[model samples]
Target: MPTITGFDYRRVPVAEDVSLNVAVGGSGSPIVLLHGFPQTHLMWRHVAADLTADHTVIVPDLRGYGDSDKPSGGYAKRVMAADTVALARALGHERFALAGHDRGALVAFRAGLDHPAAITHLACLDVLPTLDMWDVMRGTTAAVGFHLYLMAQPPGLPERLIAGAPDAFFGHFLDLWANDPSAIPPDVRVAYLDACRNAIPSIVADYRASAGIDADHDQADRDAGNRLRMPVTVLQQDWGAALGYDAVALWRAWASDLKHETVTCGHFMAEEAPADIVKSLRALLSR
Candidate 1:
């Protein structure tokens, strides 16, 4: 195992020509952590280390981010979720607890919905379902979420425009979303910017899927009145209170049994407040 100062990190092959950078530690039932946009598996460094004493931890960069293979297609949450499932299986686990942040949270949502039998529990940080997210953003709130529209633009344009200054584009969210700018250490911020700069096309493709294919999947589930069967927990900043949107109600509609709360932190809850995240996960798992 290659040691990175305080942590042990290694690359694991999840599929042919595709590998996930994973950090494993601790001992117990598996708990897989998925990181958000523009960030590698490193985002979970703190949280994973915290849980290692009591649980087996698996942290992976999503298919198109970090050290993971940046495949040209299949950026949809459903497909990305499958990659996670395969990764877990390849690592010798048939079932595991799962948690994700931002874009990764969307992938977790799909995994719980599409692969209910594979996920024992699901935790989503600072995100809502694609359809509910679209429904909640109206008027001024929509403006706050303008990135959705920008990224949803014709593929090449958004990618090209964002590529020009990837740091600025990715950093805008980090600054605006974090309640404390100091929450993200300088080195991690640089790593995030560098990764985002290189993976502009894949990042754009992931968002485009949300606007088109992901919307269709959410709508189909809504039309079918589908609901998640496992224990589900959602922790998010009060975007609803800030924008006058009913966040809990929207989430409850999708999760039959859920524990939803708004934490008094920024969008990057894991990094901003790892203690709260760990507390929430422990409580959710206990149930």
Candidate 2:
């Protein structure tokens, strides 16, 4: 049993053949933690421990990423968000605070917009809205996210290519995105690699969702003039500032009551700077 400071880690079934490896601890208002791509619920080990003193932390490996069932479909954020909502309700939480990082942030965004009554507060770390994300990048900016283009390609090729060298494929981003490569530690790196290695198809399926189904959702929201109806907090690395984009203005178009800021850190903000993530989440939840 892998142990963190305050949580008892275990696996719980979220759907048939789709159990999520979850870490539940502490006792207070429930706060569900969602992790990004190439990572799992384990990514929230540190943040969950910090919140356990006053919150019942529910950290789950989003479908297809960790110990969860690597289903062939439903990688779209809307479907994934529904899975998380069902997982929370199954665990006896009707309403709770939600926070997610990277790809998980996209799920959080969908959950907030679609199920506003269920999420009390929302926080997204190191990402932009899916539609805004694709709209802003061009040329060299797109190169930083080459995987986006590659994974967006037809399914069979991306799957086979990534599976051929899963470690190298996943490790490339893990290495480049970490401010301190050593911060992840060796054993955790190995664990991350192992999980990523086994999940190539599902991971590709997830990115594929972003390219198609997820895009449709975002476009429909735009067409419907739908905006997030909750207090939304977004902490990102200022890809907008560095790549000549307007981060706040883009988010404002989607979130009516929004507080957006750029943080000086690598993409893995929670793992790289736990204190900062904690402070940011606390502030957002308080508001």
> Which segments of model 2 are wrong by more than 4 Å?
1-3
lDDT of 2: 0.86
What would you estimate as the lDDT of candidate 1? 0.86
Candidate 1 lDDT, tens digit per residue, 112-184?
9899999999999989899988887888668998889999987689988998888899999888888988878
Model 1 CA lDDT for position 56: 86
TM-score of each: 0.95, 0.96
- Every candidate's lDDT: 0.86, 0.86
Instruction: Give residue 176's error in model 1 in angstroms.
Output: 1.1
